[model samples]
Target: MFSRKTRLAVAIAAACSFNQALAAEQEQLELDAQTVVGSADESAVDSYRSTPSSAATKLDLTPRQTPQSISTLTRAQLDDFHLDSVNDALKMATGIQVQEVETDRTYYTARGFDITNFQYDGIGIPFVYGNVEGDIDTAVFERVEVIRGANGLMSGTGNPSATINFVRKRPTATPQARIDLTGGSWDKRRIDADVSGALTAAGNIRGRAVYAHENKNSYLDRYSREKNVFHGVLEFDLSDSTLFSIGHTLQKSDSNSPLWGALPLNFSDGSKTDYSRSTSTSADWAYWDVQENRTFAELAHDLGNGWQAKAVVTHVKKEGDGSLFYVYGTPDRDSGLGLFSYPSEYQDENRQLIGDLQLNGAFALGGRQHDAVLGASWSRSELEDISWYDTTTGTALPPLEDWSGNIGKPLNDAGSNGSDFTDRMQSFYGAARWSLTDRLSLITGARVVDVESSGGNYGSDKTTKYSGEVVPYAGVVFDLTEQYSVYASYTEVFDPQTETDASGSRLAPVEGVNYEAGIKGELFDDRVNLALAVFRTEQDNVAEMAGMVGGRSYYRAVEGLTSEGYELEISGELLPGLQAMAGYTFVDITDANDDHAVTYSPKHMFKAATTYRVPGLEQLKVGASLNWQDEVYNGIAEQDAYAVVNLMASYDIDPNWTVSANLNNLTDEKYLTSLYWTQAYYAAPRNASMSVSWKY
Candidate 1:
């Protein structure tokens, strides 16, 4: 795997050199991507609706033209709601569920499956292993784009749920600067600053910088956090048709008394135990610290023949250190004497590198114009962990009625070992959009992947490899009228597994298929967009645990696990000064036996947010958002259906000044973020924040 990636890197370098030479000799052509920015098909910053998307097929197609579901969180929307974290921003996106399983570990799901494919500016490889640790701030992102369904064209692992792409903020042709100061509930305080403009005369060279600092205490006892973020970028226009861009980002978060695991919700009697939202099971000596450094470079060239060549390279380093304590065992309701504490100290470091090269352009076929794209990409991730055990590995704790975050710091009393591993993927992919007729079109793409993983987890030796696996995609769209289109598509993804069969033989990789159809409409002169989509996903070769053999567990391949659902979404300006977005989603999951499966995922969800500029007083805008979902059950516990309301109001003091406020969970709803696990933490209660900003 390593040698193959080395060869791929050399090939990409050669392609970059050729692209640079061609760019220097050719005249500049009309290039929408002269720099790192969103395409014209992207939704504007001031509107809630999007026009077109390239995240799925790499071909610019309007929502009405693309045979899939899409959602976008624009800069305007982010600022309006003060969505400071990536997790917070996704809460407003349609069909998304943010599972906050721990203070630092989170899982995101869409359409009844985990979303493992993440991208930056359309380049893949993010959050390896399907979990978000620590915090991911949104200060440096210009917009967040979501494609809800299988996307095998760009991602190596095409999860049959969704793909998230973050577009970074870039230097602008005109100079601009902004500063923001905010204070919120839970003793939260933050400041952010951003500036972007030219670095030299004639605007041939440009740069942008962003910085943010935050300090806050959580509603939970013994929990607080401090964070700092910085990002800087430089753009060099070597030639009129060529752009070379490089950027670096650093984000660090220090959390005190972070929760390694959640508290059990039930006692030994199988009855529920109610706990206050502020209750915690962390020790005063517990702390978790995380830091990440990211660097990326991009080169784009317009080939003068309407063809464009682009190359992107990204590298990331993340480190986590913590001393944690976990309390386990169902306590006796009468005496609260059954719980025990398990303590440990640990550190981990992860590194990831990815590179891609691609060419896209228009070609003539039978005297008709068509769009095509060819690309290759390679990515590798490595992780190393070191740890030491504690003094209270199995010590019983005090009674629950007197429980508090009071524990002694252990002195490396237990032994520890190293756990190191690596994951690699290399793929070549292509796609084309054929305008078969003026009103009908066909879009097709496929990706061939090479994947491998070798590592030791704790004390277990694991290795998996797959060579030359092909994932296919197909879609077609028929425009019934200038304002409406109907489309259908078949998409697929492959997920390698390590589970072995009862015969001690490795099972085949899991295969996923998605069948989808939808109708989309663009009305009111492209100001409003609406869509209704129905989708069903089938997964096969899923490993199911069989009876233990020789004191070890073996598995058998199971198929027929399926999920089907429909979604309705509408977004845009409903009135001259009113911008709104609303969506409804329904999903049903069943196993091979036709019994409910993954019931933790709500079958029905409705999310809506709208802001209205007061009549004749455009400077004053007020809005409210509501998220409602049906009851959820995880085979162990159940959470009743609930709703959360959030309110926002902002006023423009002047052209250069503004003040805003936000109130969350207005109903103070008490509910778990998820019931996917027997032990889950409660979501936050009512909270408010106020902010002021200045622009120049």
Candidate 2:
């Protein structure tokens, strides 16, 4: 119940009714006098735009001053659109594609490449290989920031796509509380609560806590899930010029009858196969469960004379266990009897500890003042996994038209094997922003890193390490005027691969470089923002799948791959009562052979969302969002361009109470989740959710 869907007819009718909201919006207010007032860590209260962002360089800079493309999903926008999950929020974010490849595993891509770097509160990068195995809730986050293109100065291994930073909410100086209950189609039920305030009489100590729980059935037969998220943080003022903070976050999800892979997209004859959207290839005994725990501590101090020091320490643990069933083979279109099913049991555990120290301040040089930061970071991670299975594997024979999840689970204790790996990283980085003149600035950064992979993983055949690797970053910005600026940047990063070649030898790490230029501006006295950017990226030693051998899949490293793209985005208070965000992206990828490659990634994408408070009715608001992408090919088959519309409306019962409703897939559009492989699945159909919330 991705919030559960209303009955089919009801959902369609309600969604169609919302079409009027978009066409009837009146002229909005433009108050050029509105000013930004808040810390960059916190979102601007009730605004769609952000205050300032350091997502690009550790130094805080306004969007117009940054030399890269950045997008943010703020708290107010999340609440207005009912985006409670990370997947849903990223779906509407500019220039990002949320690929839900399976029931629980998802992949995110931007600018024609996969995104592998993720940050928590601007600290600790979680290393993932294009996929995340469990659901991520937004209840504990103040905002989601996306830095597109290559960013090596911060997120190590600067994958050429994008980096996602989930900023956790901090304790507030004033007391506040909120409770929400939501119900959606497919019997989806969810509850969320958030509370924050000062814990001491003198207000020297503050605490904040958030919790969310959800239970729901899916559009697919025999599929269901339960999820819970809990987060808490405490901030203490050691002195008038110093602060200390500690926090912990826990997220868990358990799913029943989840698919291991997906359905075959083609039959024996090579023609694309068609199945009902509600079809499932899962057995009743299959289940997948995952949990993530994060604990962190941070300290900050003002050293006087415009100098500051900060330190952060963090630990993360993730565990997963699954009993999965996979359907493989090219089934006959008429008989559907050529497919085979295999079942297996898997368990995995991952633990990581990371820490960093940073010192920053203002310095005067030859008649000009500038800002600079120096940092040192270290990280250690260990991973363990096991695969257990029964003996029966290639058995075939079942009628697809009359199949149900009645299969019994096989004893998985027959055999077991696994892998263990340990990895470590150490790096030193520094960056500075020099104001050469009143309208010109120069930004430069550098990182020296040493990384090693000591133990062999599931597919690796040897120990791998890279020492004394250097990543460089440079950018220059020239203000055309007080409200506009033009900038250009160059950066580099490297990524290690886990996939091996036909000889079972690990492939070389991928190295990438990027060149980008953009024009940024503010309108209506900075109430509105606009950006236009173009970028080109080149990579070497990219891993690509090769033929299988001895029951094992292998990959080969390809060199000289290129990707080029452009983007346009605008977000802010277009009017006094109207807030809006819109963006368009186009990208082209060329393989080593100089041909269009990675067809699974579309060449064009467009996303837009807007919310309006009624002019005459101050207590009511309505919003609509659209996501569209051009056709994509999986090397085997192609899917046509598709668009999904979402509508939201809310009424304030009073200052402390409100009721809201959201409808997604308004036109009941049918689409595939992804074309990554020959096996794929359909996305959920039209769905709706209604909620009641109380705030104090």
Candidate 3:
């Protein structure tokens, strides 16, 4: 067995040696390739172009013309960073944090709140079992957009954190194909392919298909995963000004690892340091598995009368089975004393159906200018939860190392615990944008939601349906110059509690309001986009107790909680052959009712990356990045801070082929990726990967 510090040192050394070797190899290859092709057309710059910034646009407007703070991760950025999932894509974004909640699950937070409000191609996808197991793949996306603050006018229900929207890749009228293969440490292997082209004469119809497969192992014992994703889309042009598109995606993940909880924060006598990294207290547990299927259809038509109507329908089904295990007790208070363990086996199933309709265009009001939008949406979700417990077990399970050789047998004909049940939600909303002047705009929106929950044999009793407030929003954008703009906005969001009140009725919804102000600029031929924003969000009238309960389930709210933050983002091709992206955030989250700083929000977080092509080496590119955060407290006891670096180099083998390598966590810092005192998840050890890609 290796000590934590020893392991960290070894990983760092390996990463450094690997990167050195790769750099040498890439340089040699670049020299050989340039000799053969004589550095063909170094000034061919057609590949870089600014598409619409999906993040800033509310109605398909360009980023410079929009009124808010939006950050976008382009496909080039994704490839440079070797991003394989949504978690990987947002890792270095401003104001965003990714925390590994379990071996196969991750949580994303923005501005001190969980950002579970996700949109696929501008449409909301219903999710359950938290945000960890949702069926989303980075392979099918062209870019990812993050809108900082509330977006009630677009998404009906959500938190005030941030909204993450995935923009799917669209088929071009011309034919194209790409294939990529990657291999790295831990026997990791990945394959991704994309094919798109016109499917009919006159280019009236176009279609695309994307596929990805990944298999990998982790440093932890008996921890591994395999995943597959497939996506398809079809687009048809009804007329010059009208278009229609439809798409669907399927994702499945299989893992051979159980949920591992956090570790202790301190040793005896209130010492700050405690626990060994390799100490696993439960090795007899089986792994958990999740399967998800989703399908959707959308239609957009421009009436040619300055009006457009869009409709969307989506369906999702998800299922899971396995055991979840965790350790519980006061560690320092009872040093060297083994605490109680929680182990449970269960199965879950969820299904959802949603529909949305919207109409947008321009209207004249008192000879002024007005761009208005009206929309309505409804969704229904059904959940079935089942579990079985072993009553003969002792209060404490054997240490993880001790059980390694004595794998426990599955309980035969396990006793059954009745099922738990819950239904979905229904909502309607409308919004409009009014341009008071050519340089000023005002936006307003509102929504109404109704929700209900029903109990089963082992779940809570039935709760009658309840309605929530007509949430409202207003915003103003003032253009100081052609290249500069200032904006301020305020929006409200509400989430209805599924539990019953004193009279056996659904409780009132928790209401949250977000206020934000920001400035935007476009410099250097619209190549650089810069934004700075300050925001404050407040949530009131929250339920007291809601979350995973007794291995069962529960719900509650933190009454009067506030999260405030400042953020800055810069993204673009800074120079002809140089491109850079960076983001920084400072947050102050507090429990307003108690006047205490929240436990998980880090005060300072920042990420920056730069990629440059060598002045005369047209065939080679090199990039590096740094991500850092200030100390964050764990359960009012322990605190930890971390900084990590990444490096990459790529060489064009020919017009049709390229080779690249990436070194992740270049310094191998030993730190907890997630913690709740007594429970901790370590960051990934340094790893290296080499990839070969071909395009035609």
Model 1 alpha-carbon miss at residue 224, Å: 0.6
Clashing pairs in 1: none
Query: For model 2, how does the per-residue alpha-carbon lDDT over 1-696 read when each residue is reduced to its tens digit?
Result: 443345323433433343233223212211121111111233356677745777788888988888999888889889988898899999988889887868888878888777877888677565734478889999999999988988878866667789898988887755566778899999998878776665655566667778788999999888999999989898877776788888999999999999777778888898988788888888898899999999999988889888889999999999999988887778888888897767788899989999989998999997999999899989988889888877666667485556696776867756876668877888998999999998999999988888887766555545788998888899999999989999999998687765678776777888989999999999887888899999999999876656434223467787888999899999889999889889999999998799997788899999999999899898999999999999998767788999999999999999989999999999999888888655678999999999998776
- Candidate that scores best on TM-score: 2
**Cα TM-score per model:** 0.91, 0.92, 0.86
Q: Judge candidate 3 at residue 667 and give its lDDT.
A: 91
lDDT of each: 0.82, 0.82, 0.68
Which 10 consecutive positions of candidate 2 have the poorest summed lDDT? 30-39
At residue 122, candidate 3 shows an lDDT of: 74
Candidate 1 C-alpha RMSD relative to the actual structure: 8.2
C-alpha-based local distance difference test score of model 2: 0.82
- Model 1 scores what on Cα lDDT? 0.82
Evaluate model 3: give its TM-score.
0.86
